[model samples]
Target: MSAAPVIVIGSGLAGLMTALTLAPMPVVLVTAGRLGQAGSSPLAQGGVAAAIGVDDDTSLHLADTLAAGDGLCDAASAREIVGRGRDAIMALESHGVRFDRKPDGSYALGLEAAHSRHRIVHVDGDATGAGIVKALVAKVRETASITILEDCRALRLIKRDDRVVGVCLEGKGPVAARAVVLATGGAGGLYEATTTPLGNLGQGAALAGRVGARLADMEFVQFHPTALAVSAPRLPLISEAVRGEGAILINDRGERFMADQPGQELAPRDVVARAIAAEIDAGRKVYLDARAALGEGFVRRFPGIFALCQEHGIDPARMPIPVRPATHYHMGGIAADCDGRTNVPGLWAVGEAACTGLHGANRLASNSLLEAAVMGLNAGRAIASEMTAATVRLEPVSLPQMSDPAPVRAIVSRGLGILRHETGLRAAICALLPKAGHDDAAAVALAMAVAAFARCESRGSHARTDYPHKNASGTRKLFTMDEAFAFARELAASQPLSRTA
Candidate 1:
């Protein structure tokens, strides 16, 4: 028997990288929307983090990553992934990602929060994601072995005994494959205010969890502190690169509020997000004042963001941009090892969909791109190597009936957003679990809430209002779908339910 073609779900940096990496071998890349239109990857303004600077090294990158993770980052995986940053950048460059370079013929490395060195490799100033994805999409187009399924959403994984045989798409029915790679981005779309693309509703996590794939770190959702406070559906991210270049956060009173914190504006994302949340809770509007700092150069440096500001009629060259904390990244997903292999055979997870312990509690700025590239490459190779002669069966698996996203988004925003409490989290679990039923997004949401409920003390992005401090124990909670539902029902049964929830 010959090996079957691999089916890869999602079309972000991870999915593209994985498919491209598995070159020469046949691959079917599926996305919910047209190529390059949606997914959180193209919207990533911050460039890929890598230690390519002459003064930088992988050890320093590892230290910064570990610190940002808040003690839950898998140390071995962190070191391994961070160590390959330079190689990952080079690989991306080969695939048409033209990173910005200085006039002196060196990589124009940009600085980001919590990074010890100026090691962010960007393109077109602030439109790094757009540049990289455009190039990779072009490369994928040129490749004859890769078949792209545009406007097709993956519904569920077709299982035969233990190993995943293929994926069932929405418009297109079930497609058989020897291996499956889930690169479905994060679950940020589960929240009301988020920086992610609208379609990124944790579909990947939900699909994987439906088939008993282990999920880890479901509680840590990184909130970016500087999403443009607009009334629009999708929130525009004011890249951390702006803050890296001396932009200061201000309140309605023209006060430089970050002055009290140790690192001020340069603190880890969790710290900055919490600070912004605190300011908002205190009845003060927050703003990112780039007027004095970047001045005229703001447009030239961050043309994408500047254009965004202009699109909304707020000139960054003059006034400060109104900003607030928005759901950005989920540091949890289908638990996969370094090679992107899930607990179930023939099923692999890469990019944001896979919790490889790279991001831990909170992901450092730009590390998401780096992880996506490195892990996608590794997973591609791993899957390619696993294409053996063993015959796999593709059974007709029933797809999950998902509910309206509005209610699920509302539940996540109220129960699992910036601040969480025991009562509210339990209430949220009860509401979300029943609504979720067998839906992947709801399943992932319930998992996140259950993980949040399990962790009593605040740590990293999983902050709890009741247990207001970090606990002595540093633990990463892993859960199966059954385990999560059982725990949620048990927990909800023990507590009195809230009428509003």
Candidate 2:
């Protein structure tokens, strides 16, 4: 029989790039929904951050990334990833992705929060992610070596002797493979208000954690400060690029609440999000006033965002956008190395699903795309070099129950939201522990609650009401599924269940 193919779960930028990079090596790309239509990648409004401009360099990009990471980033990993920004951009271009360019034929660059330089490479203005995904999807469709499996979900990893041998797909049974790559996106969907696709419930971390893979930095969830405040399943994102173009944050009473801050509206996302949260908490509404800065030019610069605003009966050219904080990104995930290798052999993870220490406490805007592309390419090369034609027999495994984030959403949103504390974290753990054994979403939420409970100090996106100050020295937290469950059980046993409305 022919050797089983390398299986890639999820169809976001990272998974697509990995499958493409492993050309002629045979790959089966599995996704829960239609390819390129499910994950947060296509919903991304921000562009990729790269030091490709003559005035910019990797040093400046590295500095911005580390500064945003807030001292938890692995210095060596940050340096290496930022240094390869240009290369990642080039590789994306090679795959038929074209970034926006200037009249003089130079790549047009834009600035975002916490970025020290104009290093964001966008496409179709604010439709950067859509543009990139469209191009790559076409490229992937034409690749003969890749077998696309859409509308399929990976239920669990089939492991033997600490090595992942295949995957158990829902309704499809087991498919043997030499290796498995999980690019399953993030867990922002666990929140009541989120900018990510509602289906992204940290499935990658759940799948990995169940198989004994180490998960890290699970408490750090980055909330975007400018999601269009509307009643919807998934909130519409007001790109940071809007602020990069000089918009300001204001309260309903016409007060520029962020004016006193050092960076004003361009501060790190954590700072801006907290400031906005404070306003909302005080019974005030927040807004992003773009009239003076962009005005009519807003349509020309951010056509996508302009249209989205129009859909909600707001015109960026004339009025301010009603904005509020919403869960947007997760900086913590399955702990993976630079090559996307998980602690479990033959298992790999990339994109937001893998915490490679490139994003420590928080991720700098636009760096996500760069990291996904870079790590995808690196992992592809590593996997390709280690490819073996030899096949292994896999033991039959029962399929896991389908995950439903609905049950755990309220608990996670209450405990692990913009601000966290011991009481809420413990309450969430007690609520989630029972469901976690059978529900993947609850398992992931329980892990996050455990991590949040363990972190005693506020740092980056993780703000604690009880511990408002950051520790002089901070270290990343790593835990396995067993460790997280044990911790949660211990905490539950010691403390009475606190009531959460």
Candidate 3:
């Protein structure tokens, strides 16, 4: 196995940005598919949120992000991310990302949920992710310092004592580095309906847990309230930017009803999406009626959405698009500082795998891309600052064997799935832990269960009805693999599963 100073798992914006920021350092990037194929960034339809517009600034942007986060955001991290928004935008542009511009040479910035200003910067209409990924991939290819290993999956972290030493890539075998960055994205594939990439099965968070890294807010799973109910597991996300451009949220009876609701479709994603889910559960079809709102501008402004709609046999220029809530961003992961250093000595995290607390309860739309770019760069420099050729050498590690996946899927989907109540959460803890027999799936299931148990109070995205009260402190509960497993095992023995949960 080829060893390097830095090993980054996943090639999304976070991983790419981290590698690029490192400049001349030798790094190995292992991705589950072709560099960008398994990441959701390329499928992102909205633009990145930055405080770059004329009327917008970091303060206003920070306020919007905090409000949308629903009190879970760390103020310092929020300020750090928002304050650097302009730089992140510039970095993307400098990397040759061609953003959509107005006729006068200004950015054709659009608006999104929770922002009071038009601060979203897009490219090629609605293909913001595609454009950004194109530029990032090109940069990664051009960089002689970075080694891109595709069709590789990181199965588990190799932990020697309290710190992670390296990762075991499933087929590639053990490739060790002094420092490992968990940029493997979110845990949406853990659920039945999700908008994350299929490979975003929550392994990074679980990997972090096995080595005793502090995990933050694991229960706060952001459910993107508007995933198009496609005939797939990781359902296609219907971009929220469409609603920002004058699309209206309507029920089956052709009623425009979101304005009367708290937060509206333009509200925090959880509120808007849950509202939509309520309508759907009540035997009504929830749809985004952009046909009348955006009219012909729909095609000109949202080409990606339009194309996707066409592929799905829906005419967005004329007909309303069907949508439902799907699992999106995960707010919990290996807790990191501003520089992406986790609690472990040689381990770091960036992008969706790092919980910087910038996005608390819910992530503001498009802030994800901006976070990846900003933190990826910062983590790279941070890694370089802490390491040397004398630090450690690469060790050959082997991937752990996995159990049958069918029961694993059933456990997460049915019990730990969306809308968890007390009975289901506890029962799920009981059902999944004993079967955890030394595998990646077991570790992940244990971590998920531990998070479900500790968070007795429902706050932010983690809605638990049994422990329905929201704690005022709502302090982030960090857990180790043993702590989480032990707690889950205990809870499993005590509480019985509820039918509704």
Give the best candidate by TM-score: 2
lDDT of 3 by residue, 1-501 (tens): 443568888888888888888878888888888876778788888888998888888999999988877788999999998888888888888888999899999999988888899999998988888889889899889999888889878877876656677677776666667688888888876777788776676778777776778888777788887788668756877788888878888898988778797657788887786678778878999889887788888888877778878888988888889998887888888899989998888788898888999998778888998898889878887887874633445466555565665566677776564467756666667777777646666567667766866677776677776776778877776777777777876665666555655
Query: For every model in order, what is the number of clashing pairs?
Result: 0, 0, 3
Looking at candidate 2, the ten consecutive residues that score lowest on lDDT are 387-396
Candidate with the greatest lDDT versus the true structure: 2
Best first by TM-score, ranked: 2, 1, 3
| Model 3 global lDDT (CA atoms, 0 to 1) | 0.80
Q: Tell me the deviation in Å of residue 473 in model 1.
A: 1.9
Clashing residue pairs in candidate 3 are 18-376, 174-397, 423-498
**What does candidate 1 score on TM?**
0.98
Task: List residue ranges in candidate 3 displaced over 4 A.
Answer: 1-3, 161-163, 389-398, 404-406, 467-469, 495-501
The better-scoring model by TM-score among 1 and 3 is 1
Across 365-404, the per-residue lDDT of candidate 1 in tens digits comes to 8999999999989999888776363556555668777567
